[model samples]
Target: MSAPLRVLGIESSCDETGIALVECAPAGEPQGVPRLLAHALHSQIEMHQAYGGVVPELASRDHIRRVVPLLRETLAASGLGLEAIDVVAYTRGPGLAGALLVGAGMGCALGLALDRPVLGVHHLEGHLLSPFLSADPPEFPFVALLVSGGHTQLMRVDGVGRYELLGETIDDAAGEAFDKTAKMLGLGYPGGPALSRLAEQGDPAAHALPRPLMKTDNLDFSFAGLKTAVWTRMQRLEAEHGQPIAADGMARPRADLAASTQAAIVDVLLNKSLSALRRTGLKRLVVAGGVGANRRLREQLDEACRRRGVRVHYPELHLCTDNGAMIALAGAMRLQSGQAVAERHYAFDVRPRWDLSAL
Candidate 1:
């Protein structure tokens, strides 16, 4: 019998450097989900907070410094060494060019050093399969909602590497809308969380906000217009107060605006997701990505799915953000399903704007 394959996964897609080890059981084994042995993640939120956004060059440099240490930490956590790995996988694209290069270079270097094949996993595929890492994972033929930083897409996932695009954002994604609106409120970088924190103190209906594409017949999304609405509201509020917006976010007006913006974004997401589930007649739904960690989105989804007799699955809160576990799991699953082959050729390049549906 062949030994289980140990896959080392590296993720340096944007502002996070993640390393994780996943063990894929031999094909004969009954276990379908790859076992997550150990993982480590380093977030550059603090570093980028000062600039109120990520600086690509700085992000790339930081990934170089952090990737090695994170790999060592992951190995230590897994109680394994370099020789045990059979395959090395790294996020290949749909991210910053420099950041993707850092991870891809390190991963190929490791593969060469260890005489193992290397695989390049898609970033969105990583998120799409992330829920499989959770304690309660969903089965095949499920609807998947991928809501990462700049990407907001709904897909019909039948199995590993079998993804059918359902609908996606026409303009700014949901996460982009959140950040853009939060910026208008003077919330610093990584504004989604900060804005959500303030929204807890305000009412969603305190201010009227437009829900774009709500009446549309199709499942597509449009958050860009909602951002313009938020900007207009902020301008009007500043003029009404004869001053710039407050920084504390405790002011009722700002808090109300934040809540309204969040409600608008979440409303579109929720309605579109439900519409997908109905359209596909799928019983299970999996939501993945950083924005999936929003408390409001989860709460509303739980309630709505329950009423519709639909099952909803999400990656653990910690795993919702980009991480190596998702990337590694994606690689392992693809190989196990015979959908992708690990390459002996280590030379690499990155696609900054690769289309997930193309895969």
Candidate 2:
């Protein structure tokens, strides 16, 4: 019998500070499965919302203040403490430098204090593995489509540390396009959710929006044109209706615009994902990152995959966003796979702009 390995995971790649305690052993149940002990997350979305988007410096400072408390709370919730933490894991890159530093610094410090091993987890990898935390985990060798405010990528995940970049956005990511379009239509900060909510009451055909780069042979995406198209349409509307437009023209009817915008975005994402699946000859698809929580996107993707005879996996809505549990789960997988060991390291560097393929 192998000893149980317990890990403490920390995440601060963006505006969220998450701390989780997870346990894994070499031996699984009869069916073979990993175990999660306890996970805790602290989202600073509301704190940064007044500013329109995440403010890097503020994000870092908030993480610094929250990590310790969250860690303590998570340990308490798990009925354990610093001594039980066998390894300390944290996100290393592909986020704000200041924010990454906060988590990396705290994680390394904890590792040194606890005399435990330290593992650096990639931000995107955490997102990619988030679905594994669900009741039913997907098998390996699946296609992962990570669509977020900062990234839109398609990858073939062979295994941990084995990832192939399939395609990605050439300009604005899907979430970026969402937020920008929402702002253009006078929706406030963090527009994706707000815009999506309004879209529910909207008419899907109220406005025609272009789906950019959909016909291209390559899997690469470009949402910059989509944003531009929204702006152009808005300009035409203004020109036709005079400056500011009539209040009635811009009120709840905005819901229809939101619906049309969301439909266009969903259409592009679904087509691209299906194309990747068809090209890869793989039947399993994993959707991760912030945009993974978009209800419309998930529904459409689910239907499309069903029609195409492919299985789709998604993180629970909470896990869909940034969180520490995913990092812990990813780190535990590493330990179980013999990719990591018990060691202490003080050398920690944060990569603000890292290529997922580089890992």
Candidate 3:
């Protein structure tokens, strides 16, 4: 039997700094999902919240402060030393350039210091495969719905590194729409969760909102129109009430709008995901990324997929957002599947804009 490989993963793609260690069996050794030894994450939500959203420079600086400490925490939690890691991995792109660089630089430096090979992981690919960390990991040859802060994509996943783009967003991504609409409704920063929580208090049919591209023949998504529709509705509501709908002590109307807005987004995602599955004739579906954590989306998708006899999978709630465990797991899976290799080279680069389909 070959020795186990320990992978240390670092993620600083946006507002979160995460570090984790994962252990995988040697290549071609009857591989299963990699085991997460320990992981730690530090979210910049509080710091960025004061600014209404993430400030790039603040995010970068915070990553600098938190990465090393979080690394030590992960190692301590796992009862492992740096010497135990055989490979190092980091998120390489499609994020704030400064934030991406912080992780990339740390990863390469760690590899050089420890004399270990390092791998650069695609950010979205990490999200796409994150569900493997769940108790019910998925098998290959399934459809994937990747919905995060700035990206909404549908893809066919045959295996590690074998992804085919089925459809994608043409304008605002689902998460982006959620945040923007939340801001318009006076919801606080990190608005998606807030909006979703509020939505639970009101009727989804209270206000009519557009579901962009829901009835379209293709799998593509569009949320820009939905945001506009929400804005118009809010304006109408304010005019009718002679005050802002989000005014203090006016929680009911806000909840209703939140519910209606959430319904529109979930309706589109649910229909499009089902359509993608039907088009590919796949029975299994995997949903990943921040927006995947939305309760309404999960509930609707679960019921819909159950009626259709399709299996749906998602990462554990905490893993739905950006995290290092996904990056390490992706690297380990790639090595196990012979899709990528950890390299000895120390020079590194970051891609602020990467197309997942191109990988």
> Cα lDDT for residue 172, model 2?
92
Candidate 2 wrongly placed segments (more than 4 Å): 26-33, 243-249, 340-342
Which lDDT tens digits does candidate 2 get at residues 272-327?
99999999999999999889999989999998889888999998888888889988
Q: List the residue pairs that clash in candidate 1.
A: none
TM-score, model 3 to reference: 0.99
In Å, residue 171's CA in model 2 sits off its true spot by 0.4
Q: How does model 3 fare in lDDT?
A: 0.94
Tens-digit lDDT track for model 1 on 1-359?
A: 57898899999999999999999875456547899999999999999999999999999999999999999999999999999899999999989999999999999999999899999999999999999999998999999989999899999998888889999999999999989888888889899889999899888998788999988988888898999988888888888887777644338889889999999999999999999998999989999999999999999999999998999999999999999999999999988888898988899888889999888
- Local distance difference test, candidate 2: 0.85
User: How far does residue 24 in candidate 1 sit from its true spot (Å)?
Assistant: 1.2
Q: For candidate 2, what is the total of clashing residue pairs?
A: 0
Worst 10 residues of 2 by lDDT: 26-35
- Ranking the candidates on lDDT from highest down gives 3, 1, 2
* Candidate 1, superposed: residue stretches over 4 Å from native: 27-31, 247-250
